[model samples]
Target: MDFQTDKASLKIIRNKKLEYELPFLWIRDNCSCNDCRIQETKEKRFMLNSIPADLKPKKISINEDALNVIWPDEHETIIRFQDLELLKKSRKPEKILWTNDFIPNNYDWSDFLTDDCVAIDAFSEFIAKGAICISNSPCILNSLEDLAPRLGPIREVLFERIHNVSVDGHIYNIAHTSLEVPPHNDFASYSWPPSVQALHMLENECDGGKSMIVDGYKVLSDLKNDHPEFFKILTTFSVPFREFDEENETFANEPIIRLNSSNEIIGLRYSNQLMQMIDPSKKNLDTFYKAYHELCKRVNDKKYKSTFRLEAGNILLVSAHRVLHGREEFKPSGKRHLQDAYYELDNIENNLVLYKELRGN
Candidate 1:
């Protein structure tokens, strides 16, 4: 193995064919030595202001089980090859895109209720596909509350922890009405929206009202590829979002499509019901409307949406970050009830990772 440096990157050349060019600044910024990072917690101790704009490594040497580097400031650091490889891989998750044709795996609730392997698998399905269908669970009240921690701590919103979904004559939320709910994410008005949602069906003897979902990532990807200008506008500008009632009034101004440092789509927050009025002077209304309408149309496009009938005792766990949920209009004749709750994605992911480790996978 050899550690080499080019004009702009730190090259790790294991052999003639195995090599990777990590940027010079990247290598320095990621230094995890005891001085650069806390030895006890392995957290970064150095601040960004401490690094020079044009700083580069002074020397690169292959030490035992690690690549040793001397910085321009005469500071020494070491990074293991294994750690670097892991860091590189963790820069982004392996992406999986889907549309109406995508059929997700179903995790049996019977197995998930008992077997740790099945529980881990169910969590993994939610993490990877952003949606999963859980079948054969008890159709009892507050049953979801009892098992909500299977993923993570129950995230509290203004709504009840274990919310009851039924068509009462309450005129507060549209969800309480027997009208068609548009495809959108919930709690978008919150600055930090709920990351995961578990909708467990207690009863559904309705005529219509199948559960519909749209992949926000796939819609954004198509927008970025086909309409680059609209995508750019969406990613750059923030829009007002608000949710209000007699009791709770939540608000936030965030972009419809959020991006990371590398300009990759990271998450989405959208809700037609909660979207507030945008200031015309702050943004070009004509141009913004064009982009906004296009995004909405794409999200609601039947070709990019999936509709399924949620039977009693089936739970639909979806990543609310990139999945928009909706429901069709149903006849108010038959009984229809559902119990729902929220959880954070990090909790399910942490559980999955730990389960994998304990299983030696």
Candidate 2:
């Protein structure tokens, strides 16, 4: 390994192939010494503003696996090569895109809730596929609360902490009525919707209310490849969405597609039923409508939807940010009730890592 330094940054090269350019301020600010950080919590204590803006190392030396630097004030910083390599590695598992043929992997509820190894396997699949199904859960009311340990705390919304979806329940949304609901992630009216959702089916004796799931990420991938213009428009066009009841209200105008700093697809906001009317004179309305129409067509296409019957003791857990869930209209022939709650994806991912580490896997 070798490195070159300029006025602003240092370029590190290894094996004549891999290289990284790190700024001097970045390295100094990230110092991990006892004096720079809290020893117990490993939290940073050094402040970038406290150091000189143009600070430079007085001396630099590289050993077998680390870089040692001496600053002007006799401060020393050691950076391990292994740490740099680990930083370059991806933290999350690679997401696997699926189509209509995909069937969500199922896990026994007892094992998933009790065994650490079972949780690691289940969460691994959940992270990769964006969905999973757990069977043989309790069918009693508020049974969804049992998932708190594995999925973290419930993300309370305006309506309720745990939402009850039944024809006889609150009529705040179409989920309360026996209607064919379109594929969508709940609470899209919120600028930042919940990242995870678990739909716990307590009863499902009624017929024709089959569950439907669509991989919004997969649809967007195809759209980006075939219709780049439409994809671009979706990532930039903001649309209004609102959901409310007699006493509570929630609303936001946000883009249908979201991207991170590196331009990676991070989240998707889509709710057909909750979408509000846009001003007819909005700019690029014609083009936006064209892109939206194509999006809706692909979202509803049978080629991309997976249909299944969720049993009374089944729980359908989904990464709401990348998956869209809906239901077919069912006859009020018998009782059909479902309870759903929200959680953040960060908790589940963290739990997976913790379980794997604790089991020494």
C-alpha lDDT (0 to 100) for residue 131 of candidate 1 = 92
RMSD of 2: 1.3
The backbone clash count of each candidate, in order, is 0, 0
Query: What shift in Å separates residue 151 of candidate 1 from its native position after superposition?
Result: 1.1
Model 2 ranges off by over 4 Å? 15-18
- RMSD to native for every prediction? 3.7, 1.3
Candidate 2, which ten residues in sequence have the lowest lDDT sum?
Answer: 13-22
Candidate 1, residue 237: how far the Cα is off, in Å = 2.5
Report lDDT per candidate.
0.82, 0.91
Candidate 2 structure, TM-score to reference: 0.97
Give TM per candidate: 0.84, 0.97
